[model samples]
Target: MTPTHETPTTPPPSGPVASAEDVELLAALGYEQRFDRKVSLWGNFALGFVYLSPLVGVLSLFAVGLSTAGGPSVFWIVLIGLGQLLVALVFGEIVSQFPLAGGLYQWARRLWNGRYAWFTAWTYICCITIGITSTALFSSDFVASLFGGTAQHPGVASTPLQRLLIAVAVTAVCLVCNSFGTRVLALISKIGLAAELIGIVLVGLYLLLFQRRNPVSIFFHGSSASHPGSYFAAFVAASLVGLFLYYGFEACGEIAEEVPNPARSIPKAMQLTVVVGGLAALLAFAGYALAAPDLEAVLTGSDTNPIPAILQSSVGTVGTKLILLVALTSFIAGVMSQQAAASRIVFSFARDEMFPGARIFSRVTSRYRVPRNALLAVNVAPLLIFVFVYFSPDSLVRIAAFQVLAGYAAFQMVVLAALRMRLKGWRPAGAWSLGRYGFAVNVAALVYGVLAMILLAAPTGDPNASFADRWIALIGFLVVSAVGLVYLLTAKPDRKSTAPEGDALEIAQRLRDRAASAASAERSEA
Candidate 1:
C-alpha cells in the first residue's frame, strides 16, 4: 500500500528555529534535532494542560472519591497538588538538562544505562496506551449520558455495544488528528483548554451561586464506610481522586525537541501545568461536592455517578447537557494530546533502534513531519485495550488506573536515580537547574512519590473494592520490569549496533570510568 500521507523526502526546515546553542546542546545529549521547533511557550503549556485535562479526570473520578470517602475526600486534591509540585520541579530540572523527545525515558538513559532506560520507556508506553482506553470509556459514558434522557440511569440506555462503539469512534478521531502533526495537535489543545476552562468556571459558578447546599461544613466529613482498621484507610483510598488528577503534566517535556528554546521553556511549561491544573481540579471537585442536593443519597444511591447526578440537580437537564458537551470536547482533546505524547515515546525509542520494531516505528512522515507508524501503533494498542472496556468497564478502569500509577511510580524512581547521580557529581548543564535547592527538592519528590505509590496500590475501604484489583498494579509493574530485565540480560541491546551516540554515550563511558576509579581507591584505602 502507498504510504499514508507520503513520507517527507526533504530534510526538516533549517531556518533560525533554534539557536546554534540549542543544536549543540541536543547533539551533546546524544540525538539529532529533527522536528520543527514552532511550539511557543503558551503552546507548550497548553500541551501539558491538555494532557492532564483536569476536567476529564475530575468528572470521571469525582464519584470514585465521593463513594471512596465522602465530601472531605475532595480536599485531598490540595494535598496531591503539593506533592505533585515536587515531582514537577524535579521533572523541570531534568528535562532542562536533556530536553529530548522521550522525556523521562531519555533522562533515565542518561542517568543510568540503556537497560534501565528501556524499561522506563516500556512501562510508560504500556501505561498511557491503557490510559487511552480509560479516556475513551469515560468519554463514551459522558456522551451516552448527554444523549440519553435525564431519567435513564447512566448506563441504562447505553448498551455495552454502544459504549464500545463510541469509544472506538473517539479513539479513531484522535488518531487521525494526531497524524496531522503538531500544528493541528496544538490547535486542538488550545481549543480544548478554552472549552475546559469555560466549563469549570461556568459549572462552578452555577453550582456555587444557584445550587449549593447551605451546610458547607460537611465538606470536612469522612465517609460512612467501615474499614477494618481505621477510617484513615478510607481517607487513603479517597486520595486516589487527587492522585489521579495530577499526572500528564510531564507530557510537556516529552516533546522537547519540537519546542523552541526547550531547555528554558519546557520547565516553565511543566510548572504552569501543575499550578493551573491543580486549581481547575479544586474548582471542579469542590463545585460538585457543594452543589449536590442530597450528599448522603448521591453517595449511597444506585446511580453512583456523582458528576451527572450533581449537575442534574444543580442545573437541570439542558444545562447539564451543555456542560457535558464541553466535557466531551475536552475528552477528545485529551485523547489527541495523549496519543501525540505517547507517539513521541515510541518514536524516541525507535529512533535509537532500541525497540523491537524500530525501523518501522521510527519513520516520520515527510508531508506532516509526524511519526505516522508510531502514531498508528500507539492508536492500535488502545483498541486492543478496548477489549477490556467492552467486557469489564468497572474492573478495567480500576486496573488501568493501577497500571498508570505504577508507571508514575517508575518515573519517580528514575527521578530519584537522577538525584543520586547528581549527588555523585553529575552536574546538570541545562538553563533551568534547581541550583542550591536541588537536593531538597529531589528528596521531597522521592518521598512524595514513594508515599503516593504505596497509597494508590493499597486496598480501598469502598464496598465495591476488589481484592484482585487492589494488588494488580504493583504486581503487574513488577512482572513487566522483570521481563525487561530478562530481555536486557539475554538480548543486550546496549552492546548491539544500536548503542546511542553523541553526549549520552560519552557520559556513559565517563560514569564507568568514575566507578572503576572509585573501586580502586577503596581497595587502596583497605
Candidate 2:
C-alpha cells in the first residue's frame, strides 16, 4: 500500500490546519502511495553511500589539506570525524521515528509547532538550495580541470561567463538524471559508490606497495604549519568539513515514504551508511597522508586540483590520469545525488504550501511516479545561484562553502530540538530506539554543531582570504533568520496529529515482531 493509502495517525500536533489546498498539494505529489518495500536494510545503506558521493569527501579533504589555516593535523580530521558521528546519531534518532521527505524541516514543524517550524523548514530549504549551487560549482570545476589545467588556472578560462555556462550545463544534466525516478538514481549512486571504492583502493595500494614509507609514522608524526594553533580549534573546523562530507546520507530517510518497511529500513540504512562511509574516509585520508609529497607544497599550493598534484608526485603520469578520472566520476555522481535530495526536500515543502508554484512544483508525473516539476524547480534555482556566484568571480567557492555549512548547521539544530522534545515525553513510535542515550547524544551534537558554526564564521589568519568567506556566512545566517521572522508573523498554530492509541499499540507490536524476525534471520545466516 502507498503511504497515502496507509492511514498514519502520527501527524503534526499543532500546525496549519490541512486545508483543501494542502490536501490537493499532497495528492498532486503522489502522496497517495507509500514507496515499495523492496529496499532491504543493506540496499538502503548502500543507497546512502551513493547519495553522499564519497568522491566529494575526497575533494573536501583535498581542499582542507590545501587550506591555509587548516589541515596538516590528523588530530583535527579525527575530531571532525567524531563530531559527525555524534550529529549522525542525533539525526538517526529523529529520522528513524519520522522518516519523511521534508527532512529537518518536517521534523522541526512537528516538534517546535507553528511559525517556528515553518521558519526552520524554510531555512532548511534555503540551505539545501544553496548547497545545490555549491555542488554545481564543484562539478563545473572538476569538468574544467580535465582540460589540461586546474579550474583556478588562468589558462583554463576563469572568466565569469565561462564559469556560469559550465555551472548551467552541470545543473541541467543533474536535473535530467533526477527526473527519471528514484530507482534509477539509486542505481546510479550504487555504481558511483563502487567506482569511488575502487578508486580509493587503487590509490591506497599504489601509495602502500610502491611508496616505501612507514604509514604509522606518517600518520603520527606529520605537522602542517598552516594548521591552526589548538587541536581543539582544528577539531572544530575539520568537523565542520567532515560533517559536510557526510551530509547526504539522510536522503534515505527523505524518501522513506517510497521505501518498503521504511521505519525499519530507513534507520538501518542511516547507521550503516555512516559507519561504512566513515571507515572509507578514514582509509582514504590515511593513504593520502602517507603518499603525499612535500606536505607543505600540497597544503600551500594555490591550485584547487591538489589531488592530481599529489598523485603525479607519488605515482607518476598514469596515476594522475586515474585520479582525475576518479574525481570526474565522483563529482558527477555527487551532483546527481544532490539533485535527487534537493528535489525531494522541495517536493515535501510544496506538498505543504511552503513554496511558490505549489500547484506545479508539487505535481508528480503520472508516468514516472516522481515530482518532475519540483525536481525542475529545485535544479533551476541553484543553477541561477551558481551563475550569480560565477559572475561575481571573487566570491564563488567561499560563498558556496558558507551556504552549505550554514544550512547543515541549521539542520543539526532542528535535529537537536526534536531529540529534546522526544526526551520530554514526546516520543514517536518507530523500529529504532535511542534508548536512554538519545538526550546525551543530541546535546553533544548540538554543542559541537554550534561551535563549528562559530569557527566557520571566524576569519583565517591568511590576509588574502576572499570576502565571500565573511559576507557569505553573515548573509546566509541573516537570510535564514529573516525567514524565521516571517514565519513568526504569518504562521498560525493548529492542532497536531497524534497516533491514535490503538494505532500506536499496533505499531509497537509490529516493531517487536520485526525485531524478532530480524534476530532470527541473523542467527540463521550466521
Q: Return the TM-score for each candidate structure.
A: 0.89, 0.80
* Cα lDDT tens digits for candidate 2, 1-526: 1135223333233422333432432333234442233345655665677656656666655556434333444444456667767777777766655566766665665566534556666666666677667766665555555555532331133356666877777677767876777667676667677777876766766676676343465444334344545544443444444545666677676666556556556776777667677667666666765666555555555544566556666766665666666766666666776676667777766666666666577666644557887777767677667667755776655665566566666667676666557555654446566778877777788887777676666654344666645456666677667766765565532223221111223333454565698799999999
Pick by lDDT: which candidate is best?
A: 1
lDDT of each: 0.77, 0.60
Q: Which number leads on TM-score?
A: 1
Report the error of model 1 at residue 425, Å: 1.1
Please report, as a residue range, the 10-residue window in candidate 1 with the lowest summed lDDT: 1-10
lDDT of 1 by residue, 1-526 (tens): 1121223345645432566766666665555556767777888898889788989988878777776667788788899899989998888877877788988778887777777787778788877887787888778778888888474343323567887899899999989988887888888888888988988877887777878784678677776444535667777777878888888888898889889889899999999999999898888888878887667765654446667767776777787788888988899998988888889998888877787787898877766778889888987878876776678766666656665676677668677777778767765656787888888888888988888888777655545656666576676777777887798788876564354422333454553565588789999999
